[model samples]
Target: MKKTIYLIIIVMIILSWNIAYGEDLNLSGESYVLIDAETGRVLYERNAHKKMPMASTTKIMTALVALENGKLDDKIAAKGECIGVEGSSIYLREGEVLSLKDMLYGLMLRSGNDSSVAIANYIGGSLEGFVSLMNKKAQSIGAINTNFANPHGLHDDSHYSTAYDLALITKEAFSYEEFGNIVKSKSYTADREENNYFYNKNKTLWEYNGGDGVKTGYTMRSGRCLVSSATRNGMHLIAVSLNASNWFNDNYKLLDYGFNNYNRQFVYDSNQFIKKIYVLNGNKEYLNLVTENSLFYPFKEGERENIKLSIDVPDTIEAPIEKGDKIGYIYTYLDGKLIHEGSLIAKSTIKRINKFESIINKFKFK
Candidate 1:
């Protein structure tokens, strides 16, 4: 019995060590990253900041900018510049008109280069203006290392985005319900004269459980690039692979690793009561404090118990407190590193006691 117990103890120690260190995924991508879609926390990354050309994935941003700037029902005519564009296309004809929604379906599901140009021209007034919007959106969303030279992901030396930046862009894009609906669609039929049918090229949606959106890209210079997203047990993860030899399989491993290792846990809810604070000389003796925003974070195995929450507030606050007034802050940390923070605000108004009331209270106490 003693020998068996010793062996079990050794095995348990090994298993605990393995869980702490994590497994090495030896992915076939030159640059790859897996991130929590909700928290934007990176679960795994390998050379993720290295910039590389992304082929048709450029349409992701194109679709996003179009959705933000244009109405889905607006009719946009294909420009002369979109005709006969090289690479994948929806075979757009000059002067052909399609609704912004239909054009987006073609752009994402079919990887339509011409569709990108059409959306760009109609929404931005010119291809150059549209590309500028793409770059600006990228930068605005913290994709600092990314640059967009065109609406379509053509091979341009100036057009490049890193895996990390691509994941950031994907996270931002997924915030739109319309964009998510469009990319996850496997088939779409546009209401046009001809060649209106499209089938999504992303194979992960069919093979992987809970697989959804994103885009795929390929060019001789860029190799095969893929951005994939999956949701399991309320955890949405986004994975990006650049210059990957096995783009689909690489994402599978990346996403599988993320799901297997991390679990999304709700930390706080918006307007959640933190604690009551004593209010001196106020109509109310105490005021409730509530959080400003909700927080959810991914936790690794055994890591939940280690999380620490610190609330910073005064011991007693003076009266005249207004609802929603900033009073304090609540910070959440894991392993001594801050993970999330939110403002603690007054939950209700607390008017100061009138002079007469104060005098009466003093007299009653005496």
Candidate 2:
């Protein structure tokens, strides 16, 4: 027989349509999305999957590819291709040198077109090669709708991404601690002698509470784009806007809606003991089991009442059990729909009792 356990823990799945939990927001973006960074759940969105030019938000992917492939402390020289790039720039002169770390500060904080090229050329061996890396990274991280034509978010008819895709990219970029630190900094001073000072262009870091990231973008072709993130009350949220005249206010409302209507709830910890099961012939009479992974998910108010948990394992097992052995599984469900599943494992090894010990114990009872 299967043993089933039910508990009132928070649970839910990503909604298929706009959920009617908070006030309707008058967001200005042609395409926009707000997501729970911890669970990758979409809280709110409009035209979020429609492909459109994302402007300088493209740098998020650029920085992710470079950080994964290159070292931060290595000094990289600006190549001739990095000179005279259009739009925002830190104004790199050919052969001018800056650490890869400093160049990333320029790429994200200053929105430097030149910095993007410099980092790309050095890390990927060429601009074309680096753009390829960005696309590959995007696809690897499940941002299948994203494409990269250049290191900088310059207008290319072929270059475009969806609001949802941008949010995914930003979430992946934020996974790197250095990436978070760079985007959140108000200003940075490069090791180079001239044009060393750079100030962050993303004003969300200053104007909004708990806003620590991310990037801002504007181009005549792409309009104004912004990808922003905030952490409040132990919840981290990512908001993306494409071609919005009021992106700052739009994102602010979107984030407010999420923070106000939802909360991050802990569901399971890998170290937490699940249950004890009888061991048929072990030296110990029983063996403890624990979850194999931790789980946290965002839940709306009242959803906790519907949460349920189930476990599947043998009622009793033979001895010689090993630690970390996958004995069964724990499944979490909400409203009868499965939301999360975790592995159940033995917490410690249990050796079988020898026949001589068993015979002696019987004699002692007699």
| Best model per TM-score | 1
lDDT tens string, model 2, 1-366? 122222222122223222432225767789999999877889888888899999999999999999999899989988888999998999998888889999999999999999999999998899999998998998998999888999899999999999999999999888899999999999999988888999999999999999999999999999999999999988999999999999899899999988998999888887679899987767777789899999888899988778898999889989899999999899999889888878999999988888887676466545
Model 2 steric clash total: 0
Candidate 2: pairs in clash: none
Shift of residue 266 alpha carbon in model 2, Å: 2.5
lDDT, candidate 1, 1-366, per-residue tens: 999999999999987664443335657888888999988899988778898998888888898899999999999888789899898999998889999999999999988898898899898899899988999999899999999999889999999999999999999889899999998898988998799889999997899899998899999999999999999999999999999998999999989999988988888899999999887787777789999898889999899999899999999999999999999999999999988878999999988998788677666645
After best superposition, candidate 1 residue 235: deviation in angstroms?
0.7
Q: Which stretches of candidate 2 lie over 4 Å from their true place?
A: 1-23, 276-287, 311-329, 350-366
Question: How many clashing residue pairs are found in candidate 1?
Answer: 0
Model 1 — TM-score against the truth? 0.87
